[model samples]
Target: MKIPEARGPVSAGLLDLLSGQPGADPAALANLHELVTVQLRAAGDIIEDEDFQLALFCLYELHYGGLEDVDDHWEWNPGLLGIRQLIEAPFEECLRSAALGCTTETRLPPEGTLSSDDVAAILFGLAAQESGPSMSRYVAKKATLEQLREFLIHKSIYQLKEADPHTWAIPRLTGRAKAALVEIQADEYGGGRPDRMHSALFARTMRGLGLEDHFGAYVDSVPAISLAAVNMMSLFGLNRRLRGAIAGHLAIYEMTSSRPNQLYGQGFRRHGFGAEVTGYFDEHVEADAVHEQIAGRDLAGGLVEAEPGLLGDVIFGATAVLAIDGRLSSLIMDAWDNSRSSLRAAVPAGL
Candidate 1:
């Protein structure tokens, strides 16, 4: 959880400021903004830009659980927030574009033309119809021990804090939507048993794999595409205006979760691991089946019914999850196919 090595000038400057180094300069904020803006414009694929994505990840981290040993004051620093906005503008645009592309081929019912139940039905139907490359399928059928470990490393970025990003929506919603979210979140939190929490279950999975179980332990080893996947959730969750998007993100996340989790459990069993090693996925298989219904109907659908304007954002958010996740899956599969590690080069021990 120590400050990660800077990936570029913006991250370097931000780190320096956080570390309380005398060399840190406020002027770097403007430089960082210009650098990110120019890079975002010139880049053909922003999601794959390690430096830009990592820098933005660091910026967003300040608002989450801040980096270990970094000053809390940096969270509210005007200069840093200003620079973050510069990075986020294009990132948001890219998300919208990706979402649009994913859903354009589908025939959606006209906006406001459907009841909450109908909207939920449409979302569930669309999720059911989706036919993308299944990372879980590959893991279940063909992954080696090393490959499974690598998969855990990649997943830890989000799983270690599972459901946290979506928690930000609690204050932004009301009535049935709010109640639905709380119900789902309660289960994610293990229903009053701290040890049963999904995050805790994932930690056990990491330990079972002989991997580090601490939060952020693998951050230094993951690539930007991996980080981007989690960062997108944080982005949607943290913005009040993006509440619908976050809800949709969670709905799609649950709807698509059950089957893959089953595959994941099968994969672990294929490797001779017992329930202890497969508990996280095993839990999700059953939990998400029910959660998908609540999320699609009561949560996402109710939210849009309460506020019709958020319908587009809801669809946009759900689609973004699929889009980014597709990219991450493709990256991992490509690397494994080529006999390369999908992670960044591992950090040396005791660094």
Candidate 2:
């Protein structure tokens, strides 16, 4: 991935420091940390803060495909990790706080008595609750060609590398939970067929719409809320302690995906797009219907049954996704409702 344009002082400093060899300038690292501390203190909502979100996004990217022309060693630089934690701590707290409003302890069964089937029922209920604005409904019923393209741009950030973040939990899990995640992920990776891989399918959709298909191609085009959505996945997946959260995240994601994807395919088809342009959504419409069952019943539910103690984090993960994604949908729909671009800057239309 190319080094994204800096969104603020922290991102700018991060990019600048990453341009050099790791540990080459200790003073620069120190200054960067100090900058993060000061900015974090001054910031209101870290999740929606452009500078912090972009900075954290870039930092997490190093663990994935990495930044272009940046030092690979910086991926584990202690100072950089410290800076990421500075942002992550508050951001995660905010997510937990928001999730509180979306979930309740009464939703889950008593600690040691919760069965896998019972946990699955609770997760399905959480996924079923009607929340804020609905992006899928708008895309299906009213989005124009330009709005459709902008929607693809926002999704491109994570869809281009679909199933990766949650894959981190494979080693952290065992028995039924482990097998379930692998099963779901196998289908996500097209069951070993590279062309049919979800990311590859999504790339085809992007090209059909005359947009860039590469990962991170549109990182600069989205807003903080967009980045926060993906960042939340990375946060849960990367931390071993949050393994339950990642499981819950995947469960909710699968549970919620099928119907919207059906509507998404409908929207694209309504615009006269062909299979190549709508296949990604069509694929999800079918795949997630099955995936939702396995994820909710075997993956998340199985995990909670095995650990029991992680029940709270499991619910936290599921609700956090709804909270963040609800805000993202509202942001997009509100912009479109007002006749504006949902992206940070409008893209060229007439593709």
Question: Model 2, 74: alpha-carbon shift in Å?
Answer: 0.9
lDDT of 2 by residue, 1-351 (tens): 988889899899988999999998999999999998988888887889898899999999999999999888999999899988999999999999988778744455567999888888898889988668888988998999999999999999999999999999999999999999999999999999999999999999999999988898888889999999999999999999999999999999999999999999999999999999999999998999999999998998899889999988899999999899999999998999999988895453434
The alpha-carbon RMSD values of the candidates against the true structure, listed in the order shown, are 2.3, 1.4
Residue 255 local lDDT, model 1: 94
Candidate 1 Cα errors over 4 Å, as ranges: 21-25, 28-31, 104-110, 129-131, 347-351
lDDT against true structure, model 1: 0.84
Worst 10-residue stretch by lDDT in candidate 1? 21-30
State, as a TM-score between 0 and 1, how close model 2 is to the true structure: 0.97
Predicted structure 2: lDDT: 0.91
